[model samples]
Target: MTHPMALPVVRTLNTDRHRVALQVFMVVVVAHWAEHLAQAVQIYVLGMPTSEARGVLGLPFPWLVHSEWMHYGYALVMMVGLILLRPGFVGKARTWWTAALLIQVWHHFEHLLLLLQALVGTNIASRPVPTSLLQLALPRVELHLFYNAIVFIPMVVAMIKHGKPSDEELAAAPCRCAPAKV
Candidate 1:
């Protein structure tokens, strides 16, 4: 009943291209998490000054860590990945993936707040640094960690469910994320 070209791009992405696209998206997400973890380790374990503990990528291009544009861009990318790749999932996997996407909506909003402050040259409550709504209560580093953990956990759960899908899920799947049964 669907038009042939109605959602051709989405259909292709969800079918043949889904596996590669999801893998690439995951790599970026994991790499960003690694950067944050590296920064935390540098400060806590290596006893480096907080300001000097630039993460792996930040060591070479420090602006990557400091720029609100960069951070917001990443949030935007995460949301896009979650949205675009969603149709490939089915059953429990779809539910879990949507959970991640919903959490990311708030996460994206936080980054948008920071980016807007940077663009407007005014921070929330006249603070010295750009701040998010939750940043008012939690330290920035802890907040970022918290956000990553919540998002990553659900995503991992979705991936695992997708991989070991029920027969119904397997039947309904649009992509070959799971192995075929003999």
Candidate 2:
């Protein structure tokens, strides 16, 4: 008897699932730090600090943090949400080194927005100035790049090797579903 060649093989990570969860958890914990995550959102949305700072550029700085526990709680929730959703680009690496490079580059772009605020004040006008033109850029830029590599590397490697699940696989997992038509 001949067997079918195209049977769907369910691929699961044999290792490092716990590691992925831990790394994601750390991001959630650190995201509560005002400078790291909260401030990033505040600046991106309203162009100012969240700690009762005066507004800028016709936007009121979110004073939400002044309430203590609530702000960090919300930030933690947001961080978890961010990691649960696949960022999509991490899977395209042709090689491990390439994946590392892409992860660093993506992080640099993401962090650059914050650096602009740190050095030249949180003004939209600073967006145009090249980094070389600035008197100061954020300290430890390389460290941030490295950290992002560590966080994204495993996930990217897994994605490159395993690939994403199809709609049928996802829909069928632990749930009843109508059979697909041949």
Top of the candidates by TM-score? 1
Predicted model with the maximum lDDT:
1
- lDDT tens digits, residues 1-182, model 2? 53221222111111223235435644653443324443445555666543433223113434433332343344334434333332212323224424444453444444454444445555444553323222245433234334444645654464433343345443433211113334
TM-scores, in order shown?
0.95, 0.23
* Candidate 1 error regions (>4 Å): 1-5
The Cα error of candidate 1 at residue 66, in Å, is 1.2
Worst 10 residues of 1 by lDDT: 2-11
Residues 66-140 of candidate 1: C-alpha lDDT, one tens digit per residue: 999999999999998999889888999989999999999999999999999999999999999899999999999
Cα RMSD, each candidate: 2.0, 13.6
Question: What are the Cα lDDT values of the candidates?
Answer: 0.91, 0.38
Error of 1 at 107 (Å): 0.5
